[model samples]
Target: MGLFITFEGPEGSGKSTQARLLYERLQRLGYPVILTREPGGTRIGELIRRILVDLRHTEMAPTTETLLFSAARAQLVSELVRPYLKTGGIVLCDRYADSTFAYQGYGLGRDLEELQSITTVATGGLMPDLTFYLDLDVEMGLQRKRSARDRLPEPASAAAAFTPHPEWNRLDARDLAYHQRVATGFAELMRRDPDRWRCFVANQPVDLLAEQIFTQVEPMLARIVRLENPR
Candidate 1:
């Protein structure tokens, strides 16, 4: 299997930016790579993303949100991620199952075990080879998101306009306590699987952070190449 790397973080933590930077760096280095985002990578996933993030969907329940996200994720993995990995091309995802664990399970107070079972079925047990968690203060992250929403025009949909950052969604409007729980949830997740996760303080300069990530990833890719093509 090829490399499967994922980016995870709280709102405004710059995960998407770092993921995009890594994707470009890998491409410039002549690696076969694809960068995709959660809830909206595939055609079907994009449709699901609309419902999950629409600012008007105020009545949507936590369970409903979980199911919608899982549906989109399942479509993405089946149609794009798994197939790409089978071909030995790197797949860089902006988020994955871990988001569900952090957002729905922890932020919204859903059952983690239940979310895990649902996620397994949704993803067919697929997991990332490495996950980058961009850490930032919960309030700072949320504030950044709010500022972006104030400044950036809202795209018609996730796949419509290629904005630098995503428009603020319904989840961005959640209470501070909920977001705090989500941050805590991410911490607990990293603690559970330290080897697979690389946590970075996200407030660093963008170029510096991207270099840090690429430094770690480049060595791993070298190791994989060596193992596959032993002398």
Candidate 2:
């Protein structure tokens, strides 16, 4: 199977940019790379994403949110991710099941054990080979999101009020304490799986951050080259 790399962080952490940079870099280096995201990878996933992020759905229960995300995840894993991995294509995902753990399990005070069980079923036990956590100050991330939304010219989506810009959603508009909890949750996750995750301060220059990521992924490229041209 191909390498699965996931980018995890709070909103405005610049993880999406970094993931895109890595995907382009890998492609330039001639690796077959696939860039995708959770809650909206496949068609079904997109529908789920709409429901999850649409600000109008403020009544969405936490349990309902979790299941919706899982439903989208199941479709992505089965429909796209699995086959692409079997073909040895590198998959760079913006968010995966870990978001559930951070947002639902940790931030919303859901049972971590239960969240893991559901996510495992949704993903069929597929795990990322490397995960990059772009640690950002919760406030800074929020500010960045606000700036981004301000800069966008054609802003308001009739589908949703909260900017899920591949960005923040209804979840992000909550108070600082809620977001802080999510950030803390991310920290805890990194602590639990130190080996699988690379921590980076996302406040740095994009080029610098991307370079650091390349250095890490460069070693993995060896595996890709070998698999592609096995002698």
The prediction achieving the highest TM-score against the true structure is 2
Q: Can you list the residue pairs that collide in candidate 2?
A: 164-167
lDDT of candidate 1 over 34-134, digit per residue (tens):
99998899999988887888777789988899999999999999999999888888899999999999999999889999999999999999999899999
Q: How many steric overlaps are in each model, in order?
A: 0, 1
Candidate 1 has its poorest 10 consecutive residues by lDDT at 222-231
Error of 1 at 131 (Å): 0.5
Q: In angstroms, give how far residue 135 of model 1 lies from its true place.
A: 0.5
* C-alpha local distance difference test of each model: 0.88, 0.87
Candidate 1 Cα errors over 4 Å, as ranges = 153-165, 223-231
Weakest ten-residue segment in model 2 by summed lDDT: 222-231
TM-score of model 1 vs. true structure? 0.91
Model 2 stretches astray by more than 4 angstroms: 154-168, 226-231
lDDT of 1 at 122: 94
- Candidate No. with top lDDT: 1
